[model samples]
Target: MHIFYTPDITQGTYTLSEEESKHCVRVLRLGVGAVVNLVDGKGGFYTAEITSDNPKKVGLLITDVKLEFHKRNHHLHIAVAPTKNIDRIEWFLEKATELGIDEITPIITDRSERKVVKDDRLNKVITSAVKQSIKAYHPKLNEAISYHAFMNLAFEGDKLIAHCIDGDEKSYITDLVQPQQKYLILIGPEGDFTPDEVNLALNKGFKPLTLGDNRLRTETAALAVCFEINYLNR
Candidate 1:
């Protein structure tokens, strides 16, 4: 199915962007009366038909709409430190979106190698993943912020911080996670969170999460958390 990201679509006829128009008419060669799909990235999935197959501005008429499409019972929010290699973090974003996640925040910690992230490029990765997976909901990508600043934000769910240090005191994610509950998990950078950072998160009611004995890379750890949470929910 040819799916276009139409975040602003409502109940009516809609026009594809110039880039999408060219891909639809010239590349895909979809002509008038051809059927296509649209996702608003806000729980809206729509079926549209080609009205005017102009290469510069393909017009579409909305034929059907489904709200809250494939809605999940649980909400997951992961605040992970970005990797030094930008591609690794981008890979995590793409896989996390494909696997199913509600929100993501790039966090900066004391041992963080890379602190800055291009929001637009990361968002595009997520957008492409959403379309490839045929998902109606779009995962939210928050701007990069300090670890302390992120901790200050209020979260009314199961807060968790994953780290390799202090393994004895930490609990495996499966031991703590319950089905159909909201979850907010924190993943550290390559160097992992400092001892003080873990202590601070503990003081703030965030439980320590341990993936396993094997030490995983920054992106791998984040994807591990994503898979575990989504699996438990499933």
Candidate 2:
């Protein structure tokens, strides 16, 4: 079934946007009476049939609505430094959405190679990922913030910081991620977090953790932790 995202689907709202309408009516050649699935990205999944194929606005008559769709047990928020290559960061966002995440924030550490990101573009990537994965919920993409500014946000759950520096002080990420609880993790850039930055995070209450023995790229490390969190959820 073709799935379309319509976040504004509510009482008396059944029209697809101009862009989605063109894709459905023209590209897909779907017409009246065509069955379609729609997601509101806030846990509302609907099965609807097209009533009008106006190429500019495909109308719908909702057949069924499933609220609280695909609810997960925990919330995983991974704050990662944007990679120097924008594609790499985008890849992380796409994969993380498929794997399941509650939120993502771009954290600018002292060694971060990239500092700026377009939240609008990243959000589109998130929505596309959700549609491709057939998920009802879209992970929140927070604005980029400095490391210190990020620490100021109040979060309660397992707090962890994954870094390259290895020692008895660092625990494995898998061991630290608690089940059925909200989690916030920080993944630094390619150069990794400066010692002072790690210390500051620790002082601010983020626990030190490691992904594994081999050093990984920024995107690779972020994905590793994301996979680990999903595993823990399961």
Give Cα-based local distance difference scores for all models: 0.94, 0.89
Model 1 scores a TM of 0.98
Whole-model lDDT, model 1: 0.94
Can you write out model 2's per-residue Cα lDDT over 147-178, one digit (the tens) per residue?
A: 98888889989899988775537888667766
Q: Cα RMSD for candidate 1?
A: 0.9
TM-score of each: 0.98, 0.97
lDDT of 2 at 234: 93
Cα error of candidate 2 at position 38, Å? 0.7
Off by over 4 Å in 1: none
